[model samples]
Structure formats: C-alpha cells, structure tokens
Target chain A: MESLLRVEDLNVRYKSYRGELKVLDDVSFEVKVREKVGLIGESGCGKTTLLKSILRILPPNSIIYKGKIFFKNIEIIKANKNEIFKIRRENIGMIFQDPMSALNPFFKVKDQLYDALRYSVHNIKSQQDLQQMIIKLLKEVALSDSERILESYPFELSGGMRQRVCIALALTRSNDLLLADEPTTNLDVTIQEQILNLLRELVNKRGLSIVLVSHALGMVKEFVDKIYVMYAGQIVETASTDKIFSEPLHPYTKLLLSAVPRLTGRWKAEGLIGRLPDYVNPPPGCRFYMRCQQSNSNCKIKPKLLKLNKDHSVACWLYGDEEH
Target chain B: MKSLIISNETIKFLLKRGGSIIFTLIGLSILIFILARILPGDPARMAAGWTAPDWVIEEMRRKLGLDQPLHIQYIRWLSDVLKGDLGFSIYTKRSVTVDVLQYLPKTLELIFVAELFSITGGILLGILAGAFPYRLPDNVVRVMSYIAISMPAFVWAIILQLMFARIIPLFPAGGQLSSHIVPPPRITGSIFIDSIISGRFDALIDCLWHTILPALSLSFGSMMQNARILRMGMTDIKGKDYMVLSDALGLPLRLKIYKYQFRPASIPAITAMGMSIGADLGNAFLVENVYNWPGFSRYGVTAMLNKDLNAIVAVVLVVGIVYAIANFIVDLIILSLDPRIRRMSRSV
Candidate 1:
C-alpha cells in the first residue's frame, strides 16, 4: 500500500486569553492506500485537532507551533486558506461529529449536494445538469427519496436522512482522503450501525482511505484495517485492528476495551477512574501517570513511541522492556 | 381545555405577567406627565413675555387650568387622550394634536429617509463583515460600528450642517421647505412626500436638500448599533456547522452572507426600527436644533424651557406609541424567524 498522508512531528497550540495551551505535541501518523484507520480515544486527546489541522480549518486563535502535515507530498501546513480550499475539493473531504448540523438550514438537500459538486464540476450552464448530478450522488448514498429530500431543508429531515445527506455530499466530489469525526455519535443505535456499515462499504468497494475519529473501538475494530489508540495528546498504541483487539498492548487500551459494554459476558462495567485533568497546569512527565493502573518508577518518565513490531507500536516504558 | 400552540403560549405568558405590562405603562405614563409638567420654570409666564403685567399672568393661569388641581387636570388630560384630543397648546393656543400633526410629517420624513439607509445600507455592511469573518474588512467594519455607536446624533447633525450647509453651502440648514419658495399646497402634509406626490420636482429637491443634515445626524448612532448587532449575530451563526457545509458545498461567499447571514442577523435590528422610529417621532433635540428643522426635538426643547406642559404631554404620548409599535413589530419578526420559539411556546 502506498502512503497517502504523512503527518510528521505535528503540534498545535491554542493562544487563549488564559495562556498558551499545548493541545497537540509531536503527534504523527500516516494513512496508506485504501486504509480505514480508526483513531480511538476519548475526545480532547487531540484527535479532532489533528483532523482540523489536516484541513487547515482551525480557528484563528489556534497556532500550529511545530509540524508539517503532508497530503500526497504537498505540505498542508504552508498552504494558504484559498489554496487549501481549492485542494479540499479534489484531494480531501471531511464529515463532522453531528450529521444534523452539517447542512445549511435555509437550503434544500439538492442545492447542498450541488454546492458540494461546485468544487468538482466546473462550467455548469444549465439547472438540469446540476440537478442530475445531485440526484446521481443522492442515489449513490442510498437515499431513495432524492427528489423530495433535495427540495427540503436540513431541519425537515430525520437524523438518518441527514447523515445520509452528509455522506452523499462528501461523495459528490471524488476526493482522495475522507475524514470522519464521530459521524455516528448523534444517531440512534440502528442508525449508527447503518452509517458505520455504509462507511465500511465505501472503503471496501471504492478503495477510499478513511481516518475514522471516534471513542468506539468496538465499532471501528470491525471495519478498520489499522487502529491508533490515543490518550491525552499522544498516540499510546498503534497496531492492526485484530492485534489491538485480540492482544491489546497498552494498559489504557485494555481499560478502554474493558469499558466497552458487551453482551453475553459476566464482565461488569468497571468505569475508568480519575477525571480528565485540567489541560492547563497538566501534570509533569507522563500525562497518564496519575491514572495508569500499573504505574511503576519508569512510568513517571515521559516515554516516546517504542516500535514493538513492524506493524505495531506502543508508547510505554513497560513496552520498552518487553520483547514480544 | 384548548390545544396550546406557540402564539397562544407567548400571549398567555405575556398576559400572565399582567403586572409587568401595567407597571411599564404606569412608569412610562407618570414619567411622561412629570416630564411635561416639571421642567424648570413658569412656562405660561414665559409665553406672557417680560413686559406683561402680574394680572395677565393670573388670567393666563386660570384660563389654561394651571391653577386647577393637578390630579383633576391629569384625569381631564387622560380623558382627552382617550378621545384622541391632545388638548390646547399653551404656546400656539391651537389644539396640541394639530400642532404635533403639522410637525410630525417633517420629523417622520427625516426618520423615513435615515431609516432607509440604516435598514438597507447598514445591513449590507454587516453582511460583508460577517461573510469575511476575521478578514481586514470585517475588522474595519467592527471598528466603524463602535465609532457610529459612540457619536451622538446631535453632534453629527451639527457637523453635517457645518460641512454641508454652512461652510460647503451645498444644502440648506433648516426648515422643511425653502422659505423663499412658495410651499407646495399640502397634499400628504409631509413636505417631502407631498412635494413628490404633487410632482413638484423643485419642491421635492428643496425638501430633500433641507432634510439631509438632520436625517444624517439622527441615523448615525442607529446605523452603527445595527451593524454591530448584525455582525455579532452573523459571527455566532457562522460558527455553526451549516456554514461550513455551505462552504464545503461551494456556495458563493456573497450569496451565503447576503441571503443566509444577513437575514438572521438583521432581525433584531429590523425590530429596533420601532425605537428609532419612535425616537424620530419625538425628534432629535440637537439635530433638529442644529439644522433648525421644525421637528419635535425643537418643540421638546422649547416646551421644556417654557414649561409648556400640554405640548410636552402630546410629544411624550406620540413618542411612546412609536416606541411601542417598533417593539411590537420586532417581536412579531422574531417569532416568525425562529422555529425553536414556535415549538417551545405553549401557544402559537
């Protein structure tokens, strides 16, 4: 598989009224061809920030202090907003956490899809051409009532309907990479399943590389080829989904997986202890040192990601000593 | 029990707090009366002039009912108000309504012209600022709005009169019509409108020329506040994901800001016209005074100095009505624009 994106030594700092809060520090990852990479972690672990940095959509106050975000050999960090906007049309695409909010209230679904196609399809002369393109995209997203939905406002649609519209809009243009940030969090159980399945199918059928950002390891473990488990602002573990799920390396991953509610098991819900500490005045050394169940003397020392295998990595002192 | 809806719920909520309505009305009405009556010195005596005798002052007091019971006089005033008669103007000795109506057209005309700019032009500026978000133009507009808010209407009127009327001498300073020109036969009573209606092209031009200084002054503050509020509202809505969707879809930046952002942001400002319209009705004392425009501003100032209680009451009542109507329209617009209100309200 060829490398599609390479995020090297990425860092994001927010210059707030309070002080400079280092949100993302030295975070790096890569997505290979047709890869469904699941970024599983609690929010505020710099997952969403990493995604926004990819798109250059971070608010004005946020500063990218250090890093280079490379998209297909192009340095995204140096690109101006207009250049990024132009690039976003053909090279990348993103879906937000809340599907319902991902659409303009005043416009019809058809108009929204047409807007999405504006970056892809240039020189549209007639209304019928735009309509046909939108209808075709809607059909691809599996929305049967394309005509009616296109004419309706976003608020009028159901959650599943809106999510489908969002997905459809993203698919309107042939973008290289797809970034989904908790796309199914706002949906019902059945709808979440449907969206996840749809995303998996898109990745499988069309060879679309997706960066799936979510806390749900169980959901992504099924569809994603590789998994990156993040805590605080660093990736604690990176391994194939099968290896991560079957023989989880990091203590945090074990705890995170155990916390996932499951059926037909005597396993009781042992909630992860300790609160997310205030980002300002964060504890020195290892961020998870206070919360780690098996914290030893070496655990207090900040650890870099230690490569355990060609396909797996773990950022823990315990992993440093282990040969397996 | 009947089914509850948004409008019904809002009405019930408002009506339930019946005390607030009554209290507001009483407070306003009392303030109006006190403002009318207790200004500085003896008004009737002022009208009587410096050479008039003590006996004449006594006669004037009796005739005008200044010597009568204040409460009895207030009741009689309220009764006359109910009958739509504003009583006699102590200065002109004409019915206060007739005096107010004769001048209303002038003030309303200034308000009408200024309001056009405040509503249309001010909103357009706000939309431009909002569309760009953190752009340089947005920052410029933001700063300008603050400046607009800080400057008083009267000061602006004076400056305008000095620049355009006095020094530049491009336009006349005061009066609804040129004193040299024979006034067009009163068609709509408002000189500008009547002039336009009668196809008195010269009169129309003259009316506009005389109005410029005062209208510009009065509209300055309103335009700033409207733009600021509009910018704020637009900025907030811009943060919402729908805007991103619009951008993602590749909607024209112009269309997104003008059609989507401006309408939502301008709702409050649109409603604010009620207060400005009402304020315009009362007249800007400084603007009217500076331009020598014969609007309520001049009347109110003169009435205060002369202690013309009847004229003051007439002005206050008209001002209050204008204010109420402005707010009423704002409320209606708010209800229409926001669907959340429709769902949450117990009555529709």
Candidate 2:
C-alpha cells in the first residue's frame, strides 16, 4: 500500500506556566493512498493535536520535540515556507471541528471559496471563470442554491450548511488528502451522519485519502476502513476496524468498546474507571496502566507498540515478550 | 457613483442616529446653560466692569436678561439659538457665532492635520507591533505608546515647542504664519486652503511650517492610544480559528494580516479614534495656549474665564455636535467593515 501521510515518533509538547505538557508522546501514525483512517480518542487525548502537527499548524507555544511528518514524501515539519505553503495549498486540506468558527465570519462564502481557489489556481482567467469554478465546487459538496449560498455569510448559514461549505473549501483545487479534525463533533446526530456520508462519498469519488480524528467509536466504525485508538497522547492500538471491535487487545480499547450502549439484550454500558494521566507528569509506562485492570509489575516501564497479529498492533506489557 | 445610493437600512440608521444626536445636543445645551448660569463671576457683572456704579451694574444685569427666571432665560436662549443668534461674547466683543466661525476653521485645520498623522501613524505602528508581538518592534511601540499616552497633549506641546521651536529653531514658535508674510485672502477661511488656491505657496509653506510642532503635540497622545488599542485587537485576532485556518492553508503572511486580520482588528481602534476627536478638541485648548495657535479652543477657554455665557454654550454645543457626527460616521465605518454589524443593522 502506498503511504500518503506518515508521522514517525512525533512528540509534541505545549509550553505552559506549570511545565511542558507532553501532548503527543512518541506517537507514530500513517494513512495510505485512498484509505479512510479513523483516529479515535477521548477529549484531551491529543487527536486534534496530531492532525495539527501533521499540517504543521500547531500554536506558537507548541514545540514538535521529535517528529517527522511526511505528506506525499515532503517533510512537513522541516519544510521551508514556500514548500510548505505549496503542499498545504495543493496537497492537503483541513476541516476544523466547528464550522461556525472555521469559516471567517467577515467574508462571504463566495469570497472565502474564491480566495482559496485563487491561491491554488493562478490562471483563474476571469470573473466568470472563478464564478463557474465556485459553482462547481459548491455542487460537489451537495449544496444546492449555489447563488444564495455564495452570497450568504457563515453566520447566515445553518450548522449543516456551514459544514458543507467547509468541506467544499477543503476540496478546493483537488487536494489529495483531507484532515478532518472532529468534523461532526459540533453537529446534530442526524447532521453528523450526513456530513460523514458526504465526506466518504467525496473521498471515494476523488480517489483521495482522509484521516478523520474523532472521539465517537460508532462514527469511526461506520466511516473508516482502519482505526487507531489513542489514549493519553499515544496510539495504544491499531487494527482493521472490524478486528478492533471483535477482538480488541489493549485494555483501554476493551473498556471503550464495552462503554458503547447496545440497542438489544442487556444494555450494560460500563463506564471506564479513572481519569486520563496528567500529561505534565505522565507515568513512565503504558499511559493506560493506572486504569487497566490487567496492570502488573511489568507495566511500570513504557511499552513500545508491538505487533501480535497480521495488520494488528498494541502497546501493552501483556502483548510483548520484549522487556526493557 | 454607486456608493452614493444609500440603502434603506443605512437611511433608517442615519435617521435614528440623527434623531438621537439632536436629543443629546438639546440635553447637553440644557446642562451647559444651567452650569453656565450657576458658575462664579456673573456674566452681567463681568460685562459691566468693576468701576460701574450700583445702578449701572443693575442696568447691565437687566439688559443682559440675567434677572429673568432660569427657565425663561433657557427658552429665550434656545429660541434665539434656533434663529441662528448665539448672542454676543463679552470677552471677544463679537457675535458668538462669528467668533466661533472665525476661530473654528483654524482649530479644525490643526485637528485635521493632527488626525491625518494620528490615524496613519497609529495604524501603521499597530500593524507593525501586532505582526511581531513581543519582538523588538512590539516592545519599542509598547514603551513609546505608554509614554506618549501618559503625557497630555499640552505637555507634549511644551516639550515639542522647546525642542523644535526654541532650541533647534527648525519651525516657528507660534501663530499661523510668519509675521512677514501678509495673510492670504480668506476664501475657504482655512489659511492652508486659501493660500494654495490663491497661488501663494510661500504663505502656505509658512503656515505649514508653523503647524508642525502644534500638530505633532496634539496627535502624539491620541495616536499612541490608537496604536495600543489596535495592537491589542490584532493580537486577539491572531488566535482566531480563521487565522489558524489561514495559516493551515499557508496563506501568505502579508495576505493574512492585511486581508483577513486588519478589518476585524481595526474596529476598536476606529471607535477610539472617533471618540478621541472630542478629547482632542478639549486638549487642543491647552495645546493652543502652549503653541499660541489662535484657534477656537483658546477662545472657548477665554470665554469660560470671563464667564462669557453665550460663547461657552456655543462652544460646548459645537463640540457636542462634532463629537456626535464623528461617532455617527464611525458607526457607519464599523457597519461596512463587519458583515455581522450589517446584519445587526437590519434587525435594528
């Protein structure tokens, strides 16, 4: 499989008055060409941070201590200004969680879309050409009434409509990969399904890849081909979506699956016990060891992600025989 | 040409704003009139002179209608003001309207030049400081603005006069033009404009040369205030979601700052700039005294000192009107800058 985006040993930390919060601790992730990869994690698990790091868009105070994020063979972290800009404009596009804030309130939908288009498409001949290009982009996002949508500001649109516009903005100039950071987190349940479906359709139709960072297990199960379960700034497990659901290895992944409410039979949605480890002074071991019922004396040292089955990996003392 | 066609919403906004301004001016007039009446050193007494006998003082008081009931006096003054009669200034010994008309243009010209500098200098400094916050430029502007804002315009006027006028002798010390240059014919009543239109470049140069110290003194404080406000606004805007997205999209730094960041960040600064005009006019009096510029603010201070009731009221009213007009224009500018405000205007 051809890898479209690969992040290796990415350690990101945010500087605060207290100390450096190790947000992304030695995390490695990858997405293949035309693949839908879902990154599932709880709130403050650094799923969004991972996506931001991939695009090198993290805040000024955040330091990428050790990481190499390659988007289509271009090293994003160390790329020069112009090179990074070209990659962002032509290769990768990002869709933020809140569509309301993602779109600049002052600009009309048309202007924002046109502005993005203008950067990528230099020879955008005339006003009519630009107008037609925008109309086409709007149509691709399933937005009818292109004229009215173009004329209206972000505030004027509904949540779903704004999300649609955001998606359209992301798809400008034929981007190869879409980084959707909890794109449906702020939408209604029904709207969430619609947006997810729209995204899947767009990705498939364009032969484009996507890395969807989300907290909802059910949403990820329905949308992505593979899943990477993140717990406290580390990818604890990775497997085929169905395999993770059927035979989850990591204890945290097991707890997460058990927590999902069932529609039939005895609906016992067991809540996981314990809070996330404080990143400022994270335990030097499997981050989930505190909450893991299976923690032993061996759980004190950090566990590297070790493969136990074909196309399945888990970072746990129980899975790996190598003791270090 | 198309911009001249005001939308119905704008017309409604203007009418609503205009109506409120009139009410505010009326309220201001009543307040000023009452304050003027209660002030020490009676205007009638001032007009009559200390050597005048008891009967003459009484006659002066009667003639000036000082003995009339307060409300009657207010009504009389209001009616006369409505009829374009601002009464007479005992200090200037001229019609209050005439004195204001003569002095106001000079004051306005000074303010106009000062404002030009303040707006441009302030916004430029703001952009510079905001773009590189906490860096060398930002620190320099921060320290400079703090110092400038701490000092009043008059203090700056004295410092500037001493530096440029006396010690360096780069510019003239005081007044409108050099004594040798005969005054240009008052076409627009503004010496700068009159001199230019009448093809007297030498007089125009002299007028401008005399203006620099006073204008710099008047502008420094307000310009610093504008810079601080806009810098804060721009810094706050830097962390917005759109700004992050713009960075994610790798939009050019200049494009993001000018196109995306500037408009939203400029709102607070624009509001401050508008309100600063009123403060500037008030401060201009002290500055005028220091620079010896013959402007309306000087007349206003003299009117207050001599208890020139009519002149004081007229000056206060004019200042209020100018302030209100400035705010109205600012409201319009804000509306245009922010589409959200435009939407709000419709609901209003």
What DockQ does every candidate get? 0.33, 0.73
Worst 10 residues of 1 chain B by lDDT: B339-348
For each candidate in the order shown, give its overall lDDT on alpha carbons.
Answer: 0.75, 0.89
Off by over 4 Å in 1: A106-111, A122-125, A146-148, A276-285, A296-302, A320-324, B1-85, B128-148, B247-252, B280-283, B300-310, B328-348
Worst 10 residues of 2 chain B by lDDT: B1-10
Instruction: For each candidate, give its TM-score against the true structure.
Output: 0.83, 0.97
User: Which runs of model 2 end up more than 4 angstroms from their true locations?
Assistant: A121-123, B1-5, B346-348
How high is the lDDT of residue B93 in model 2? 86
| lDDT per residue as tens, model 2, B119-219 | 99999999999988989999999999989999988899999888988899898889998889999998878998999899999999999888888999999
Error of 1 at B32 (Å): 5.5
Q: Which 10-residue window of candidate 2 chain A scores lowest in summed lDDT? A: A315-324
Model 2 TM-score, 2 decimals: 0.97
Predicted structure 2: lDDT: 0.89
TM-scores of chain A across candidates: 0.94, 0.97
Fraction of true contacts retained by every candidate, in order, equals 0.30, 0.65
- Candidate 1's docking class is acceptable
